[model samples]
Target: MTEEQLDKLRLDGTKVRVVRDALELNDVVGFVVAWDDENVLIRRPNRRVVKLKRSYAIVPASEPRPDVLTEN
Candidate 1:
């Protein structure tokens, strides 16, 4: 994704999952922390930071789940 798009996600505090390949094990679920011309930084649920190259990163088309869920 472009820097602008990524920035929107970051600003909105959207949750995203990054998939590098078909393997489920390689998928990462987190929020976009920041991004530059080179890499995108994400913070996982465990508080671990991950950096992924912009060229290799793929953001899914689904809407992100809210940080907190509620039942009507």
Candidate 2:
């Protein structure tokens, strides 16, 4: 995401789901705490902060509901 977009997420204090590695499809769910040009710090539900690359895919936590729930 762009810097402006990231800043919005951070400012909004929105819980976000970050895909640090698309290949693994492992999601790190957290709130955007801080960020720089290269990395972002996410405060996880466990109250731990994780630093991830700015290039990673980040989305609002409430979105992207499970497919099982969406499917009939």
Q: What lDDT score belongs to each candidate, Candidate 1 first?
A: 0.73, 0.80
Across 1-72, the per-residue lDDT of candidate 2 in tens digits comes to: 887888899888889988654333578898998888899999999999999997767889888733432333
lDDT of 1 by residue, 1-72 (tens): 887788888888878887666555677788899888888888999999999887654564275432221311
Model 2, CA-based lDDT? 0.80
Please estimate how well model 1 matches the true structure, expressed as its whole-model Cα lDDT.
0.73
Q: Residue 2 error for model 1, in Å? A: 1.1
TM-score, model 1 to reference: 0.76
Lowest lDDT block of 10, candidate 1: 63-72
Q: Itemize residue pairs with steric clashes in candidate 1.
A: none
TM-score against native, each model: 0.76, 0.75
RMSD of 1: 8.9
User: How many residue pairs clash in all the candidates, one count each?
Assistant: 0, 0
